[model samples]
Target: MKNKHLFLFILLFVGLVFILSTTYTVLAEKDRRYYENTGEVVWEIDTKEKVVALTFDDGPHPKHTGEILDLLAKYNAKATFFVVGENIEKAPDILLRQYNEGHDIANHTYTHPIKTTIPKLEAELKKTNDLIYSITGHYPELFRPVEGQYTDEMIESVVKQGYKVVMWSWHLDTEDWKDPGVHRIVKTVLKGTEPGNVILFHDGGSNRSQTVKALEKILPELQKQGYKFVTITELLYMNNENEK
Candidate 1:
């Protein structure tokens, strides 16, 4: 009886170990794919060159959108803007300017709601996607969840509906909402930029003058540093072609 009890205990110990191992593997994978839930593209890019994709979120605001475009034009750089749907609808002309000036406009959802399991996420996404298509004549393949908030279902739904999840590799939290000074914004980006890095800047909601000012300095500085700014699609396309 003693021997049998010892064998049973050993079997239980082995079973516990196996369960723990499997659990770890599952958690790691879930973490790996968590960014996908944000309704953005999380694919890898080629790092062969000193190239980066500069992306902006939450705008097309009349106040700052035009200024942001002017700077990009001055530098002859293209960027991707994840725009809120309601904002786009209110300012179709700004959307036109973005398209006309040679930038890709992406969806950031209609209401820009926080990404919890809200009943409105699906509708919000659809509304924004539709609004963008209505004005630009094309739907952006990429998206960024409002405030970078998301759940697993949010990622799955966007993918199922045909969109790539986009996130930044370098974020100094411009806190553009708080209007951090232009010097701090420019310094943060210059100090943090790296090859194949995606930098986040903003161009909407409240005063984004600091963001506008920061770019005036950083765009030219980054050019001198030998970085080429490309829209997300162009960057991805270049990398894909190289791989082939």
Candidate 2:
């Protein structure tokens, strides 16, 4: 009888531990933003190829977007732009140039809401996708949440819209949205970059002259290091190839 009682205790102890861990996991994952892990979401590609995905967020900024495009052209590099929907309405021509020049134009939600319900989030994503399709006549396959904030439900809603949710490399966020000095932005990117890195910068929602200036140095320097700048889709293609 004592042996049977001990066995029951062990089973109960294991079940309690599992319940505790699951509760912890749910708490830890809710409304958090950072790197990607163990899901359909992609944060950084896994590859040895000396290629980087340079992604700009909250953009289609009239002046800065054009300047960034010019700098990208100067280096013969490609990038992905995650454009907000309202900004797309304001700067349709800049977005047109982004598509015309063979860059990746991705959805960044309609209102850039960081805290929202699942239905609201779905509405925002669908609206942005519709706007993109209207302009480009092709739906974008990639999306990034506003401020990179999401819960599991939010992710599910985004994926249901048929987008691959993309976040930036944890180390490669240049934080140019804060108007960090041009030198600092340039240094962060140059020093933190690695193969398959997705570096983040912003061209809207703030003064982006620093970002524009930082790229003047970053693109040429990275080019010197034999890194080919690619769109997010191109980087993912390399990752898929590497798996085979």
Candidate 3:
């Protein structure tokens, strides 16, 4: 009777161990699958406000940045500029102007390398943050990676540096980077805009005259439609308030 009891106890213990191990494996796999599907990156915010964010990347250009700034001022609109460190170094005055104009300036990496290792990304972010602080007396609270390319490691690195990653909605690409004429750029933005959308434009890395022209048209039209242009920070803040 004692031998039978011992055999039964061992069998039960083995079955329990197997069940626990299988359960762990299944949960682990489920978590991995969830991360795989849901980890792409934030593209937009869902809100009912008739407000949108206008964000310009790769800028602080001598001519284009100034032009965009003037246009924003004309319309009494605000924007965020994701500036490259190297460009800021070359045009600190432009960056200073952006800050002085009450526009949000964010990091877009130091050299704008497409794909980078962890160490390199850290270096890029640190260098850019340092430069921005030197000019604006504050480190950037926001960051947008080069070309909107993000990885798990990259996101981790950015978060470690105390930045909120920002992407856009309603791209409004304009292909302005391609110098695709002023009319095309204007049409694209006017057509693509919607309430709570974030529009993307470039004010650097090539001639951006078309972008300037498009903005002249896009800004007034959006304003006429009762749309308010806010910075990314403001947009997020509004969403938070609504959630609460």
Quote the RMSD, in angstroms, for model 1: 9.3
- lDDT at 243 for candidate 3? 64
For model 1, what is the error of residue 221's alpha carbon versus the real structure, in angstroms, after optimal superposition?
Answer: 0.3
- How does candidate 2 fare on TM-score? 0.85
Q: How accurate locally is residue 171 in candidate 1, as Cα lDDT from 0 to 100?
A: 51
For candidate 3, list the clashing residue pairs, or say none: none
Count of clashing residue pairs in every prediction: 7, 0, 0
TM-score against native, each model: 0.81, 0.85, 0.82
Q: How well does candidate 1 score on lDDT at residue 221?
A: 95
- Per-residue alpha-carbon lDDT of model 2 for 132-233, expressed as tens digits? 888888899998877776567767777777888888887888989988799999999999999999999998886799999999999999999999999998
Give the higher-TM-score candidate: 2 or 3: 2
Which candidate leads the pack in lDDT?
2
lDDT at position 142, candidate 3: 90
lDDT of 1 by residue, 1-244 (tens): 9999999999999999986643422332346444433424553464768887888888889879899889999988999999988788778999988987888888887877763454587788778877877777887888887766555566678778787777666354455666778888888889888777777888887788889989999999999999998888887677568767
| TM-score of decoy 3 | 0.82
Can you write out model 3's per-residue Cα lDDT over 73-148, one digit (the tens) per residue?
9999999999999899889999999999889999998898977788988888889889999988988989887766
lDDT of 2 at 6: 100
Stretches of candidate 3 above 4 Å error?
A: 1-41
Q: How many clashing residue pairs are found in candidate 1?
A: 7
